[model samples]
Target: MELARWTLETDPAWNEPRIAAQIKLLILDALGVAIAARDAESSVRVGELIDELGGNPRCTVIGRKDKTSLLSAILMNGTQVRALDFNDVQYFIKEGKLSVAGHCSDNMPVVLACAEYLGAPGSRTMEAIAMAYEMFGRLRTLMPFVSPWDGTSVSGLIAAAIYGRLAGFDLVTQANALAMGAMRCSTPSIVRWGKLSEVKNLANALIAQSAVQTAMLAGRGVTGPLEVLNDRGGLHQVFDPALDFERLWAPVSEPPFIMTSNIKPYACIGTAQAAVEAALNLHPRVKDRLGEITRIVVTMADLPMIRKQQAEIHRQYPRSREAADHSFTFLPAVAMAEGALGDHQYRDRRWEHEDIVRLIELTQMEVSEDLARRAPGAMPARIAVTLADGTVLTEECLFDSGHSFPDRGLSPDAVISKFTAITAPFIPQGRSQRIRAAVENFETTEIASLMALLQ
Candidate 1:
């Protein structure tokens, strides 16, 4: 749990041009996703809650001119970023096992809030974000738990460290922040399973709020057991006993893990990215034979397929946007019908479209043992459309476009396009362009100036 000693020691990779560009792209992507989701039902509810629990204005909320408490700002901003589930992801081979460490941008709101509050430069914010990403990546690899909600816990740890560092806390205070944050970090698996709800999206926000409070407490001389991770009946005993401590404290490589993280191009769950791609690929062939198609079979890795099956409510009828986006059958069906899967596809009206619903009913999600075995490295999926004329057209997507797989990763221009497309709807075109330019030159800009433009 001595995270300060391990993270404060800077590595040269933190200053590498490639790593800096990757971090800027990730931050811009996160901001764009948050801005696009500013009006989302969940985000609106959270914003109202913040207004009701009004505190001294300390930091600016993204896409809003008003300011609020540091904790409230982090909660609202983090919720907005995750509202659409279109943020980035970090996957790695840890202890010889492939794992996803959740979305990297989950910790960015905390970093930005802290930096803006301190009047720090954007360069400093970027450095803090890089550190948080490294910490999250390392800890997630060490503790590969079953629940994806555990990523919220990892975000809490990273938030505490970032806030503590920005506040000029000592090593002991930083350690206490980690211990307190970890002690308070625990989420049930049900948040993401079965019928998804607003809680599924708010989980990270709740953790980010708690992390800011815990870090503040630590800065004010609050104390927590430093041996939180290694002690008996501590983090290891309470959750993820299989944690690989050696790997958790291991030295990182030159470019760091953020460079290897993925920026999602779709507005759905990460597991469904490849399936969506497959559906898009198959759309062209099935466009003319929509009425003639008898059934559509989707083959994916076992974990995702099982997740879709377990959400019985979504399978039968996805009544809410949250459930619809998480549904494997419904997502691909939307992609097949519309040739795309974006925020608009999850609207209540769109869900009622008979053709898409019929496509959902006709869809069959199957488990592919080969694909399941190749998971974490490749989220592969195959889609086959069987027409009434007995013609079966099929296509497979080994990796989603945004996935960081060798030459298959999304291009810089593609990332910028995604940012502009999502962000332009909420803000004016000129403002969107300014946001992009600020992020491009984030190294020289002040965090406050960049944040002011967000309003």
Candidate 2:
């Protein structure tokens, strides 16, 4: 309801240099992921869709030379950003409880798309990104219910706002854009459940495209329910009854929301990060004992373990790459067998490897109340390997690398390394370095140049 008013009026403390730096890192991290996934199946599929939906050329798709309509560009670029599932994630802290909001990078494509279309500078892009992150973070804290749709829906609204801002829409027009964006985009939770598909990665992209379309309509004088967020039977009533309107309308923070987010070091679901780390930690100890491993027990929080068990029938024989990547049993087993979990591990029928399948067949997941209690702050997990000699080795991962843990948070150099490695295949060494340098000095670089480097 008041989200529109707040979006128009709120003066987030973006003048701070520290916050500026964090925003830059977030954008760079997202771009790295997108560029790296240029050749991924999901990205290629979305590119084909863009071709099918031919429109006026306006924006460039990352890692591709083709330019398409604004909406098409957003869809293609957004899908690439999430194709590998290695983008950054937002961790919302409320009432001493921690909850994952969504991927902050989902908002980057919309911002970058709009900026490139308008020839806006990197500073403008950063400001738009900060706005999106602030809105997404605050909205997550306000929502009372947890649904997979929250990320895409919230991202749609933020994307609309960014598009409106770039188009020089007045407060009223921008608010209308938000209203329309919110009213139209309703993603389903099924995208993440059961046997996953390419749709899983494209959900956010669709919402973003819808947001841009709605914003374009609003900019041209179209109107929507102004109180879509809080009106009777509106978003609040339809999605979450426990919505915290007070906090949602409250003032913005000093450090900003991007600072609280975490980058993923591995290319898998966020929940599986800790488990994979735990499994990898135990990999060295059992490297020579694979033939002797009779059982591998993974204990994690109740909810995560339950979600993993939902696919018990397919854990050892995943029919799709998406399915294998999201499987708790499969991912840990892959970590143990390959010593790493990345794009390569999920390809070339690696999920069907004899050792991995054996490990998956031997693996068991159990709900640990202790681990559940430690969740939201620490995604705790324990992996125990029982060898043929009756010897058991156990290792626990409390905070995954690249997470926002006090000591484990990824440094700038580490982030750069990750970006470089992921995009190395698609982008040449010199070009990738130039892109990184531009992001490092993003405030002065124009978004057009940055987008060019990405292509």
Candidate 3:
């Protein structure tokens, strides 16, 4: 669809304080929200990564006793935050939808590190984040993401945006860095083993690191193509021929333009968000009727046969974190088996339960147009439980937890509880509280202070 006339250049204005304030709130909220999840696997991975990369006690790695360099801390912490896919998500409500949970995390590490390393103020850090986040959305629209491109195409742009903002690059320099980064980083496609590995969670870190590297290069008088997006072999033409420049730029000049976002309730793939809710809703009712359940028919609208069918493989037998997120069958199966869905429940030996296996095999998935309409983030599902006696218990969830609907926002307390619960296992109660407090009070605090708390 064509978008109204709007371009970043046509309506560029510098509003440092308001935009900086906005970035600060988002940073704290995302950090706090991620810390509050209840994913042991995520906590453990984060903890280990922190210990592996030792640094000066200058930076605090939340949910850990060890401190690290600002860069390492952000990298380790950001990756861990998203490791379980339980971090906050930013997406659209209807018509157009794209996700930016990890990408923001990408900017967090880069921006925070830049702030601490250069002793930049909180406003600068915020500007870095806002710029990177904006670039992430814009570049994604104009490029192909996570395909066979081994190196990050958009990642470098995000990095450049973040770094350029902090290093005080003007629009011209920033544009050049963006263009050069795009040209240098573009490739055929990268293996999307993200569906099957922790490496997927690390995608943000890699992107962030690349962004920083590119920005540093630009700061040092390095130059790249200025017409990166509009050039002969520019990103727009080469990356995604279907890209709608008009639509992308329509609100390109508007304030408060960043509207797409979602906070996750479950630590699984975007597609599994609705399934978890459906399974959870069915749990209390199915408790006593577990044995009576002869067949479970799960109907998901919008998802393809592959996504729905792949779940059976992982549900029956999961291989890795990547597999777990993509599995439509396993999440609900484990939820039904363990009474709830959490990181451990999926990776725990309890997944070997015979009843769960039987349930997974017996559980069937079907697609509906209604489900497809919910694609990209809101994955809607309907679960019909057929008892041996012919009784059927059915539950459907189109608006699940952490979906970010204005009328259906997840409880803020629940958001905090989730962050504390996830980080508690790795961090002491006192440290967890401190981290929570820092995030809660992120606006007033200095960016350095925030970085100090994480180290």
**Highest lDDT model number:** 1
lDDT for position 91 in model 2: 62
lDDT of each: 0.78, 0.77, 0.59
Q: Mind giving the per-residue lDDT tens digits that candidate 3 earns over 428-449?
A: 7887677666655554557667
- C-alpha TM-scores of all predictions: 0.92, 0.92, 0.79
Ranking, TM-score, top scorer first:
1, 2, 3
| Candidate 3: worst-modelled 10 consecutive residues by lDDT | 1-10
Better of 2 and 3 by TM-score: 2
lDDT of 2 at 16: 61
Model 2 TM-score relative to the real fold: 0.92
TM-score of 3: 0.79
Q: Write the per-residue lDDT of candidate 1 for residues 1-455, one digit (tens) a residue.
A: 44676655566667777778888888889999999999998899999999999998989899889899888999999999999989987666644545555787887888888888877777777778878888877777655554444556676677888888777677787888888887767666577666678887888888878977988999899998787777776777334646656655567764377777788889987777888998998888777778888988988765533444535765447877877877777888888878988888877656668887888788887777687686557667888989898999888887777776432334687689899888877899988888889999998988888888887
Give the per-residue Cα lDDT of candidate 1 at 350.
68
lDDT of 2 at 221: 95
Error of 3 at 188 (Å): 6.8
- Clash pairs for candidate 1: none
**Over 4 Å off, model 1:** 94-99, 147-149, 237-242, 302-317, 369-376, 406-410
